[model samples]
Target chain A: MHTETPFKTHFNAEQAGLESLNIKSSNITFVSVSDMLALINQYGVEQLMLGMVEYLEADFKRWLDFDKSPRFAAHSAEGVIELMPVADHQQFSFKYVNGHPKNTKIGLQTVTAFGVLSDVASGYPLMLSEMTILTALRTAATSAMMAKYLAPKQSKTLAMIGCGAQSEFQILAFKAILGVTHVRLYDIEPNATKKCFNNLQSYSKENDLNIEICHSSEEVIKEADIITTCTADKRNATILKSDMVGEGVHINAIGGDCPGKTELDAALLNRSDVFVEYEPQTRIEGDIQQLPSDSKVTEMYQVILGEKSGRTHDAQLTIFDGVGFALEDYSALRFIFELIKQNKEAQQIELLASPEDPRNLFGLTQTHSTPSA
Target chain B: MHTETPFKTHFNAEQAGLESLNIKSSNITFVSVSDMLALINQYGVEQLMLGMVEYLEADFKRWLDFDKSPRFAAHSAEGVIELMPVADHQQFSFKYVNGHPKNTKIGLQTVTAFGVLSDVASGYPLMLSEMTILTALRTAATSAMMAKYLAPKQSKTLAMIGCGAQSEFQILAFKAILGVTHVRLYDIEPNATKKCFNNLQSYSKENDLNIEICHSSEEVIKEADIITTCTADKRNATILKSDMVGEGVHINAIGGDCPGKTELDAALLNRSDVFVEYEPQTRIEGDIQQLPSDSKVTEMYQVILGEKSGRTHDAQLTIFDGVGFALEDYSALRFIFELIKQNKEAQQIELLASPEDPRNLFGLTQTHSTPSA
Candidate 1:
């Protein structure tokens, strides 16, 4: 059902005549923002997130197979732009993401991202996708996935401390993944809380979820079984204090994802067991940056592999200091790539130049000249 | 005359009603392979290379202002994929490129690339372009730009070894930028040499340039004032020995760009005064990789900035061991971004998601719900 695009058509026409050469097409599948939303609409968001969590769990189980490195970041006065790349034996993926705390002040997203998935053998990109929405989905899915192993058993209350762009997704993921029945929302700006409460109205009604709006962090965390702190301040602000959090609570701290940005009080971290996605990256960008370099933390991959313990007792406080890892993006991209393959409406773009004769790249620019046989 | 696409239209309609918020559009300009070819056809290939050389030289002159790093590479048994990222104060650009020497056996190009350029202020991408063709152009422009500084006075003959995809572009860049009047070509495969010769026929005839084909590296290097080695072998087979290269000849060695790949003999690198684009990168990937790590080599930026000398005497052999740098890609991306801005046929793709209220990213996914302002 794919359209006859130039990149595919040219290569296919040449391939039909020269099947012995085993030519590969250079067309790249592109999933725009609209396309992503349509896919979410086609397959429910809950189903997509469940699929993504499966992929994330599967990838994390084989974590040793990946070639992982810390992201390459370019820091500026305004914000940071980063490239996060990871690879397995068969596929390679990378995400280009930017974070500017002041972007919302000017009516822009605080974070935006795009990514590519490629074949390892041919080294040609198989898919290029917009990751703004996908990133939100994956981040929330990751937090919820970790919560499956770290959150208190039979937990039903989720406290969302920052009602920003990521607030609703976090609530949905918890509700869908962990059977969360109640959401307590708080934000510094009342309008933000009102906006998030309004956005979740239909989802809460349809899913039998009870939602409450609170005025302060202390009020929000009163009966929260899981607390998610995602404030967008670029400094070390204590969104949660030592005495504010109770035992048997899980904290997913995601917003403090840069060098100088952090959220939890140091005393709070000292009193709790912390888990992170990738230790090397979390040390520099996660909420645990306030802690010493040798601070005790467990990597979630180890927990998933049954190599390490997770949430040992009912009274234990667990914090997931997630700065987001490249492997999650790889899983997300791979999941979406499979979804788009079955989607007849998927769009393909001519991102690479493929000539009939690979050696005759210059011949592509020659409109009037043909390749010499 | 841009089209009224969904991304631009939605953002623009929202932006007009909320101009006080200073909303920016999320549309990314896309230059497909057809667009790149059209651009080369619109502006002559020689002229584009000349313009690109000016940018390469200007960016190299202000080298310290840039944030430079070695490419992040993921190597496999067959090939490697790399991400080269570099940024200055105002803009950031990164190229995603792959090199697979065995790709041609299956009818794929040995190398293919694409890149993105973004604004540092907003951390939003401004353009996305197909860069397989662009990389070839920039590599040639960078080589010729360096030759302008190190080639001997009144240099005319350019002996090109390994006439593959990059051969004609190098010939054109040298002819346009350095005023080379004659070219001698040699390749291990006769068809490659024949293809390059046929490709350059019209340009050579129109530019008053004489071109000849030689069977051996030694025969091609005779009477040569500048030699460029761009063979595609991924091993340490020497394309040029010390005895083959004559005095007063500058060599632009570009093919040996990985750890195990070396095109020039060790004795040849030892005999020449090596100049490199970036010393740390070249020490691992360029022809200078064959030399000792402590071997003295001048960075081309220092020479361009007048901090060091270049081509001191007629008999001095100067080799520009170029592994290609991110700065050259940055300059080429910047140059093309400007060009596409003026070209009306430039395509725009929806590579980002933009909601009216930045904090209400979830509102974009909810098709039936209206924002409760």
Candidate 2:
């Protein structure tokens, strides 16, 4: 199957589709930030959260069947840029993400991302979607997925320790998947809390959920069923100390990703039961970085696969230390790729060149009409 | 700066180009296989070889400035797919390549590749290019550059082993750079010999180059000044025995690039002075795989910088065991990306959707005609 076209064979490289079965142009489906807000509004965050949870459960069950590779990371003084790649026998997906903590200083979000979904056989990229919004949606959905399997039944209150762009997504996901009716929010910046408070007011009315912005992280974490810290600082910030974290309080640590950029105090990690996406990667990138090399933390796959206990007791402090996995982005890309493929409103952009003669790709320059994916 | 546009911007993703800077939009350039063939015929192979060598040499000298990430690879029962990433402070490039020997049975090239050049600052893919044909060109050009620094000054003839798609480029590169006038070819398949012979018949007139089809490998090895093994077999064939190798011959070993794939005898490595692209990678991928880990080998950069010897003795056999490096692709991409930019053939590809309102990504679906970054 790996022969160069006999120069004369009508095997145009540009015309090759993602399927590789025949040459069809690729359709790059794009989702901008604004479109994402509209999508969330139309379906409602509750429905989006539910959709994501179901997708993650299905994707995780087939984890071993997929082709997984270590992410490609470029380290800078300020942050890191990474490309995470994953594929099964058919679909290939990769996410481009950056963790520049200084971005907020310049009026930009701390992280931004986009992704591609392609066919493994043809190697044609089928979708190029903006993933900044999708990432927020998926991360929240992942947290809720963990809560469904591990959190105590009838969990209803959540203490959100850092209310930012991702905080609302987290709140909505919990409300949708875990039936958390109330959220107590806290942020370093007072305006950030106001923004979360004002933005979530409409969501509160629609879902009949209650949200209160708190003055301190300690006050929010005092008596909640779940605690989520999504701080964006580059330095090691102890947003949640051991004393603040109570029993049976699931800690959804979101921001402590890179080395030396942890959020939770090491004291809390020692007392809590930890779960990670991928052990090898999480060891270097998750809140588990605070723990020893030989620390006994279960891979989330084990929990998903039912090989290990998630919450041993109703009073255990369970920490879902998520440091985003390639697999989650893999599932998200496929979900959106399939979503847009079925919907007529999802516009298709031509990104790959599919010519009549793969060998005669030079003839495209002579044409007046521009081709899309 | 990352704000999404109120309108949409578009471009092809898989077409070829490299990272280019612009204040407004991301400029992406492309070169398909036919365009390369067109350029090859128009400029002639000599000029393309010369330009590639000049560009490759420039990038090789500034090697320390690059942020080099080791290539990520995924192996399978049938073949392997690898992602090679490298970047200087200004430009970044990555190539996706797959090696499957059995692919020939289905009429596909054993190795097929495409790549993107992106800007580090904005996180935009500026160019996507077809690298299959360009890979052949760069591989040949890299060989020529090696011979220029390593080969004997009075080299006249080259032994062509395992004549394939790469055979023509290698021969032409040698002719253009080393003034090699004669090539004696050998391949196990008679059909391959016929293909190589027929392809280069047109080049014979321009340079008065002589090509002889030989019956055995020994026949070609005895008289040639350089020997290039561009074979496709995945096994350790030991095509060139230690005893058959002559003195002062510069061996360009290109085909024995993966683990378990080698063309040279182990004894030949002990007898010949071995030089590699990157020692860490070559240890696992090159002909030196036959040798022990501690066995000393010089880096090509050291030889280029004159910190180590290339050919210390007239009688010593010198080998350039090249498993293609990311730097070569970086240089090749820079050259092509610049070419399209200068010729005004490149266009801005809207890859990342940076909206006016970073928080409103969900509103993009309703505004289909809206512009974004």
> Quick one: best TM-score, which candidate?
1
Tell me each candidate's i-RMS in Å: 6.0, 5.9
lDDT of 1 by residue, A157-185 (tens): 99999999998989888977888899999
Colliding pairs, model 1: none
Which candidate leads in lDDT?
Answer: 1
Question: What is the Cα-based TM-score of model 1?
Answer: 0.93
Q: State model 2's lDDT.
A: 0.72
**Model 2: CA > 4 A from native:** A1-49, A66-70, A87-92, A104-109, A116-130, A340-373, B1-49, B121-125, B343-345, B357-373
Candidate 1 residue-wise lDDT at B332: 90
Model 1 chain B is weakest, by summed lDDT over 10 consecutive residues, at B1-10
Tens digit per residue, CA lDDT, model 2, A182-255: 88989988877877787778768977888887898878876688888898887788988888776887888988
lDDT of 2 by residue, B92-144 (tens): 78887777676555544566666777655544456666676678778998998
For candidate 2, the clash count comes to 61
Error of 2 at B345 (Å): 5.1
Candidates' lDDT values, in order? 0.86, 0.72
Q: Which ranges in model 1 have alpha carbons more than 4 Å from their true place?
A: A1-23, A368-373, B1-23, B368-373
Worst 10-residue lDDT window for candidate 2 chain B reads B1-10
